[model samples]
Target: MQEFALIMAGILLAGAPLVLATLGETITEKAGVINLSLDGTMLLAAMASFALASATGSAWTGALGGMAVGAAVASVLGLTNIYLGQSQLAVGFILTLLTRDLAYFLGHSYSRQPGPSLGYWGIPGLSETPLLDLLLGRQSPVVSISLAAIALCWWWMYKTNAGMRLRAVGESPRAAFGRGIRVRFSRLMACLAGGALVGLAGAAYSLAVKPGWGRPQGCEGAGWIALAIVIFGGWHPVRAAIGAYFFAALQVSGIYLQDIFPSIPAQVFQVAPFPMMIVTLLAVNLGRVGFVQDLMRRYPFLKRFSGSWPITAPAALGQDFDPKKGL
Candidate 1:
């Protein structure tokens, strides 16, 4: 029974962070904005959170600082894509690559130093409960917060008029503009909000997940996986949360596998996540599936769901978003 409880705990730990970031990205995409720069946002947040926490011994402050960095970076993407008439996907992807290189260059020294990490918060009486304790006795302050955010985003996106406009913009910007809606403004707001959530996701990695910060400290492809999860979740907040947790579980399980199967090469375990991520990407983008069209028709409620968003066109892709065309 104890072993059973331990296994469940392991699954929950794996699912938490992925749930946060995926749901956050899911919200952003629901508004027709995609922030590929999540990678940078996460890395920056990780560094900033770690640095601030180390300097002041306030984990909350560090997390907030990381969120700020993520929001600021996300705002830049919104500005470029909305105001400057840049490709939202291209701008976001570029920002992701740029932020990573910059963090690596700036984080050389800090990466070398180890800092305090967020200790698991064991709920007092709840943890004492027989079976529940093993399942949720150990909760991060942010896990509850993440779940709350997902619920909030769902309400905002689906239960409100503003959300309606946001969805219209994503579905067809020109059609939305024709309806007298402020499509650009809506998109911009979505971008900023998305950026802030991505930031929160990054900060979680630094202050809550890891004990310290350094180069490659805050995040690696966590942001990219968040992107995939958004698709896996069908651009819905709740599904995104589940997708995130699934990814997290895979990650946490990898550690156990490493120890259990010591005969297996460590590098294989290390690279396990990438394959999982790749498979998830392919599986989530099920447009090519045989019953995809039938599935959509059968589940009429899924008509509103969005799928994988493209970040850029090939060197010679179809028509661009021409300003002359009034896009």
Candidate 2:
């Protein structure tokens, strides 16, 4: 039982980064911006956080540094895409490569260095409760922050006028503009805020989960996974968080499988989650397929539940919002 609790804790901690990244992307997409550079943003932020932490020996400072890097990169992406009217996707992709290579080059000196970690913070009474402790009480502060971020983002996006405007801009810039909303400003704000969250996720990876700047790159590929989880969750904060935890659970289960089935190759277990998530993404996007439509028609009940099950992206996702074109 204790082992199970520990395993659950590990899974939650692992999911923290994904939760943050997915939610950030959801917000960015909701505002009609596609920051496809999440992969690079996370990588650069991770590297920057670790480097700063090792140099200053302060985890908080490192986190701020990481956020700065994320915000800066996001600002550039937003400015070029929103103001300059460049292709968001193309600019994001190019920035991704550029930031990634820049991290590898600039972060060379900080590689394999020791950094301060957010050590465990075990609450006395709360930590004693097995389930409660594992879920919320006994975790590190970073885990708690991730949970809080989810609830806060969900509320902000669903219950606020500002959030409605964000959705409005994404759904129809023309309509939103007619209502006196600043489409470009909203998108730029969203991009910056979303990037900060992504940076925080990267900081969480280095300053707590993995606990150092070294070999193995614990944060590698996380950005891509988070992006997939965003789609899998249908772009809703709560659903996206669930997807993050689900993916983390799968990853932990793979480790267990490696132990149970010693005869199987370890690499297989390691690579399984990627393909599984790919299948999930494909399934989400395939909802409108002819076969799916036919099945839905055959089962009237399916139509009623489809929307509730897989949250869909905003209609204008990835499109450039042009205010000059009568918007």
Q: Report the number of the highest-lDDT candidate.
A: 2
RMSD of 2: 1.6
**lDDT tens readout by residue for model 2, 4-101:** 88888988898998898988999999898988888888888888998988778888899999888888999999999999989998999899899888
lDDT score, candidate 1, position 96: 88
List, residue by residue over 59-177, the lDDT tens digit for candidate 1: 88888787788778978987776677787678888898888887777667788687766667777898558787777777666766776787888898889998888777777667677
TM-score of each: 0.83, 0.95
Global Cα RMSD, each model? 5.2, 1.6
Model 1 spans with C-alpha error above 4 angstroms: 122-124, 284-327
Q: What is the model-wide C-alpha lDDT for candidate 1?
A: 0.72
Model 2 residue 114 lDDT score = 67
Report every candidate's CA lDDT: 0.72, 0.86
